[model samples]
Target: MTLTAVMSAPPVTVAPDVPLSEAARLMAEADVGCLPVVAADGSLLGVVTDRDLTVRWLASGADPSAEVAAVMSAPAVTVRADHTVDHAYRLFRRTGVRRLPVVRGGRPVGMLSVDDLLIDALRRFADLLGPVSGSILHDDTEQGFRSPGPRTVDTNGPESPVVGDVMSRALVAVGADASFQEVTDLLQHWRTGSVPVLSGDGRVVGVVSEADLLRAQDERAAEDPARLTARRLMTAPAVTVHPDTAPSDAARLIVDRGLRRLPVIDTEDRLVGSVHRGDLLAAAGRHATDLADRVRFALLAAVHPDAFSQLSVRADDGLVVLDGRLPRGIGADEVAHLIRSVPGVREVDVTARPSGPAEVHGDS
Candidate 1:
């Protein structure tokens, strides 16, 4: 789905000739980020946000009563209503942007933001499945489920599980010293929606989402439309959740509280992991894929006595290749075919060496 599918009708806007202070006042009253400045005929001129006014114009001693056209971001990033969700993600990542002016016939129809993209991605998937399904289900942490998609369920029900269970331990974070530009680079590199803002001691200090940075820039435009700062722009008191909490509870906390992300905590309140709206829905996919993997293992075991016993599997860009020994009752070709049935297995290469007690070579 694109912004057109989920976007609201034309957002409120302002004229370039308006005073900087007046624009800021309107934004505060309306509670909006970046406004698209338009011409008399309704043609787009430039854009401004609270960040621009505060940092650029006001903080720098520029007259707030001055025309907004003096400091608005021009030729705004725009998207059509029919653009797909993936398209929005790509653009946001590419431009390090938070919002896009939706245009129809060259006229601003709506505004789209990374937050909207995140919410849409999750909400669309939410309709298909829940964190634990109709009811909470526990899963085997030691074993992989048939292979689930982004939402792999290690457990079935809403029982209090260990933090190590559902939490994605591999968290991507950034330093406060990192520039706004670099933050976008890191998030895009990881294809993540948000990254934890960490201090030197690894303490969770804040968070900077695509929306945050964009909003910051817009605020700057409203002010002087030039300066930037990470400290001033980040969202502090980061949202969090305990690792052992039930997925259902996490979902409730997020949905009811209007949160897009939650930092997963542990018994001691250390930042152990994170759980997002997408994570819950992804658990279901993981469950389905896990089931598929299980069947694959079973079939391989039944097909060849040592199908899995003697071989080591290696992955290269999502392709599974088998290496090592060709154990008793197992043929190299047969092993390849057997292992290929694994759910995530794409292509396989078999290079099996016949088993032997021992071999020694290269003597001085």
Candidate 2:
């Protein structure tokens, strides 16, 4: 798609000599996170965002009334309006600019945000098809789905168990306003990758993943890190499952769809727990022979399933490696309680995936 098709037209700007306090007021008045700083000749000199003002100036106790030329961040990131959306995507990620100024003959003509691309993605997936006609989710006989056999939830030990027995009642969802990085934050925060995107009407739009954000991050770094934003990074036309979906069926959906996590929504399409590939792995009592991978995946599945909780439970070695997702958005304490409760379990290894860093949501 062409950027002109979606770029916000005729962005506002301020002169380089404008007082920093005035620039702050302009941001507040215009309800924009960043503003273009222009020269007398209409050439772009610098750009300013809430972060620049707060982090580089305010936090440092710089004079608020200083001219923007003194505190504004430059050189500004810009793109041609005639370019394709892909060009804008490249520009944003490469420059690490949330809002890119569209230039024509060195003058700002329009603006495009990472949110614009994000909104377009959600619009594309608006009203996700659950059992839509000929939908992928409706297909049966898709292998790897195992029937839930009776497992010992309670071994007459103090701990009681099973995935269905204890998932959270609340789930945080992403909106069009949310960027790809924000989804990573949500997943890393919730300790699970892949979060459902909700429309204004509360309909499920799409899902975002670390892979999506990682691709964006890589793409941005591929060009310039300062330019890319979440909108340019998300994958659209997401598939989802209902919360009451059988763990086995959900696992099948994850496998069949080649997905890392599936959004579990109610009839109203509100988000519930994330059914990750590892979640299913734990439910089936399957563990990777790569001993450490198994124990941690199991413990997380038992304790904090919200965060991309995967326990690589090595029933033989009793060594467990715990990797917690929810990067910048969440920090989870080790489930010392759940760790001690596991039968024949020995060591616990914990690695928390922080924001901006990639976390593997599904098992290899």
Candidate 3:
């Protein structure tokens, strides 16, 4: 499929002369991470993202009244609306950008995002699985056997790590009435981009970020900065997750929502901790290492000790690679299948040669 088939059309665009605060407001209103900065004629100029606002503008202490051009990533990497989804995928992989502006005739027409591709893939997968699933249910019914509904993961189990496992229990939060100075101090002290704003009942009500503060500062330039309160600056109805939430799910939420952090709440909806993008990444790395260890252990049990010793196992981001020699009667595909059966193994690569002794050459 082409980008036109899946991309969001008439994407929210910003003009170069738009104020930084206005760009940020547009993003918040559209619930988008980035906006394509277009020329008056609707030609693509650059792209600005939430990160640009935070790092280039807020962190750098740049004036909030600065134009979007000042912080936007110029000469943006773009894709054609007619380009194949595969081409877009390659651009994403090469550029390491989560979103791309789709252009036609050098004019921004749409926007393509990794999330859009993922959703398309999932829809295709569901289409392929639907018939098989229906067949299974039909056979089960005909056999007078009740098919159990979908199985849910037991988060309490050791196999699956939850948000509680990786979230920072030491949380820095602010009351709804916290002064702007107090919020800034807390953010600086905690070294976090944002902090959860809690209500009088200690329930998370919103989030206040550096971008928010900058916007507030610019909008209320006449007012005393110190008089601004968290409630007035916070993004209301904060997106949150529970302690039992899966780390992968939390990461997805953070990325999809372009959020720097998610407040971890308990049954009472009271903030207990927070999980940041970095925290999820560190956890994922650790999980990949642990999975590698598990793959090695499983290989050791499945193969001869000598062969297992000769094999090398490595994993990164859930892709496991096994290389070396396997004993006679063992096939690479067999080993790959074994590895694939392991939970959390997204993919497996096996390159093994049958073990054999070096032959002595006879005099010719």
Candidate 4:
């Protein structure tokens, strides 16, 4: 689906010349986390997020009354309204930015926040669950409902879930110079299996897993060991995933390489989050739900409402069944083709009836 279908429109904007305090006030009033910094002609100049205000301005002891331009993130990252939601998601992962201005002919038309994508996804999930759950209730078989979609091993496919969707955002990192005890404390406190060992530049240089700590302890007991630090204990040259990495691919790397966690990094190679094997498994498990949602939402957005207002759709085990009346000149094959384009729908079964009929077409 195109970003226009999910992006929040009539975006709240701020002038680059506005006071930082006024910008913050605007964000509070609109209950938004960021504001597009636009020119007088509505050209997006930059973006100012709450984090920017806190980290770049307040933390730096900059004057609150200064122009927001002083603190705003420049060279705005953006996506065209016509871009696919998948494309926008890729941009989000690459930039590590939470909001992207949706533009049309160089003018800001809307904002696509992570929240917007999440809500859209949830609504689609609801549509998927409604019919599937209803059908499950009517069936007497012991078989459980399975979603139709490509599984995790097929990450190269068009519908693979991105790392941003499954990665753990509650980041816990240890500096390369941090003492072994400090690293242990952080791991214990976060209850995470591993921690990214970060260089002075804030880039992940290695990883310290439970195994690494145990190995270090063994070595320490074997002899009088040197002062242990993250740099010393961590396994170097970490295997990492970009935020846009496909879950299947990430899972393969984890399983094949015997990694406990995969650090998520941006284009700049800075640590953003981490994805563990369990996280990838969870994403793999949700494949059907994700595909069902994608198919339902995409078809609903593309189908002719005049002909299919009363149409109903349900997905089961990669098969899509449609029950509805078709308008004159519209064919079920055409509708089925549209549904087939969705990533996970294995087969499209459209029970189409003629315009005026109360009877069903195709299979019962």
lDDT of 4 by residue, 211-256 (tens): 5654454344455434777898887766677776656566555554
| Better TM-score candidate (2, 3) | 3
lDDT of 1 by residue, 1-364 (tens): 3466666566768998898767877776665677888888886666786556654664456764789888888877777666544455556666776777777666788877766655544444443333443222224354421111122346665443332466678877887677655665676678665687777766666777655654454475555423354555577656565554545555655665567677764434355678766566444334333333333333333332123445665566547656677644346676666656656666777776866442221111
The list of candidate 3 runs beyond 4 A from truth reads 58-65, 84-90, 114-162, 165-194, 198-203, 209-218, 236-239, 245-261, 267-270, 275-364
Cα RMSD for predicted model 3: 13.7
lDDT of 4: 0.65
The lDDT, on a scale of 0 to 1, for candidate 3 is 0.70
Alpha-carbon TM-score of each model against the true structure: 0.49, 0.39, 0.55, 0.41
lDDT of 2: 0.54
Q: For candidate 1, give the lDDT.
A: 0.58
**If ranked by TM-score, best first, what sequence of candidates would result?**
3, 1, 4, 2
Cα deviation of 43, candidate 1, in Å: 1.5
Query: Taking the tens digit of each residue's C-alpha lDDT, what string does model 3 give over 322-345?
Result: 878775446788888888877789
- Report, for all candidates in order, the number of backbone clashes: 51, 38, 0, 2
Q: Which stretches of candidate 4 lie over 4 Å from their true place?
A: 127-364
Clashes of 2: 38
State the number of backbone clashes in model 4.
2
